[model samples]
Structures are given as structure tokens and as C-alpha cells.
Target: MTVLYGIKNCDTIKKAKAWLDNAKIDYTFHDYRVEGIDADMVAEFFAQLDWQNVVNKRGTTFRALSDDTKASLSAETALPLLVEQPAMIKRPILVHQGQYHLGFKPDQYAKIFASA
Candidate 1:
């Protein structure tokens, strides 16, 4: 099974969910706002995927971070920040089997899911 992790209200997440449903793909949704993500889980995700892929620098949540905080972000710094703020991580992290995908792009999902 695949796991789709993101906030329920995010338009990107909604699109991702709808795409998966339309494609007849099964996925489990993980809402960070309601459930609150864990540091350990973030750390584990980092371990499995590249730090750059896991972090969402383009998001408003990232832009709103303190300059010092954003400037000092190394992989180590990023992991904790992402844990404390799940929004810092990219939206709609799709995990299937042992592979991980960050963000939701229709073409990208098509490529990935096609292989699955």
C-alpha cells in the first residue's frame, strides 16, 4: 500500500488524493495537522530520501522561517525543523513499498505509478 502524507486542506494534497482515486490507486492519508508528525519519523524519512527532496524550500512555511533558521539549515538542521514543522517538508509525500516521492506533479505521478 502507498501512504500519502500532507495536510487535508492543502490544494496540492487534494489534487494528489483525487488523482490517486481517479487512477484507482490505493493510498493511506496522513494528515499532519490533526495527527502531528513525529521527529523520529521525519528523521527516518530523511534517512531514506535525500534531504533536499524532503524539504520544501518553495513553500510559504519555509519562507516564514527565521532568517537565521533558514540560513543555518544543513541536513541536520533541516531534519529537526521539518519534524517541528511538518509543513516545512514537501506536501504529499508518497511512500510505496520502500520508495518515497516528494510533492505532487501529475506527470511525475504518472511515471512513478506506471512503474508500480
Candidate 2:
């Protein structure tokens, strides 16, 4: 089964949800804002994904962070920060077949989940 994890109001998350609906692919939505995220899940994503790719450094959330918070971060420091600030994460993390996808694009979705 596919599980989508993100904030409900995020545009990318909305788009991904809509695309999944349009495609008639069944998925469970896990709103991080309401449900909350833990360090282990954050670290799990980090384990499989490059920090530069998975972290939304350009986002307002990251931009608003203190210089020390951003500067002092490495994998060890970043994981807990991600747990504290879910918005720091890139949206619409899709999980299926024991794999994780950090974000969504229509074409990429089409190619990746074509058989589903």
C-alpha cells in the first residue's frame, strides 16, 4: 500500500494527493502537522536520501531558522531538527514497496507508479 506523509495545506502535498486521486491509486494520508513526526522516521528518510535533496533549504521554514541551527547541522544534528520542524522537510513523501520518494512531479509519478 502507498502511504503519503506531509502537511495537508502544502501545495505539493495537495497536488500529489490530487494526482493520486485522479489516477485512482489508493493511499493513506498521514498529515505530519496533526499526527506528528518522530526522529526515527526523519532519520530513516535521511538514511536513504541525500541531505541536500531531502531537506528544503530554500523553504521559508529553513530560512527563518537561526544561523547556529543551520550552520551546526550535519546528519546527526539535522535529524532531530527535522523532527522538531516538519516543515523543514520537503513535502509529499510517498512510501511504497519499501521505498521512499521525497517529493512529487506528475511525470515522475506516472513513470514510477504506472503499474499501480
Steric clash pairs (candidate 1) = none
What is the Å distance of residue 46 in model 2 from its true position? 0.6
Instruction: Put down candidate 1 lDDT per residue, 9-95, tens digits, no spaces.
Output: 999999999999999998889998888888788877788877878898988989998999888888888977887788888888899
TM-score of 2: 0.93
TM-score of each model, paired residue for residue: 0.89, 0.93
What ranges in model 1 sit over 4 Å off? Answer: none
Best prediction by lDDT:
1
Clashes of each: 0, 0
Off by over 4 Å in 2: none
Candidate 1 achieves a global lDDT of 0.87
lDDT of each: 0.87, 0.87
- Candidate 2 backbone collisions, by pair: none
Cα lDDT for residue 81, model 1?
82
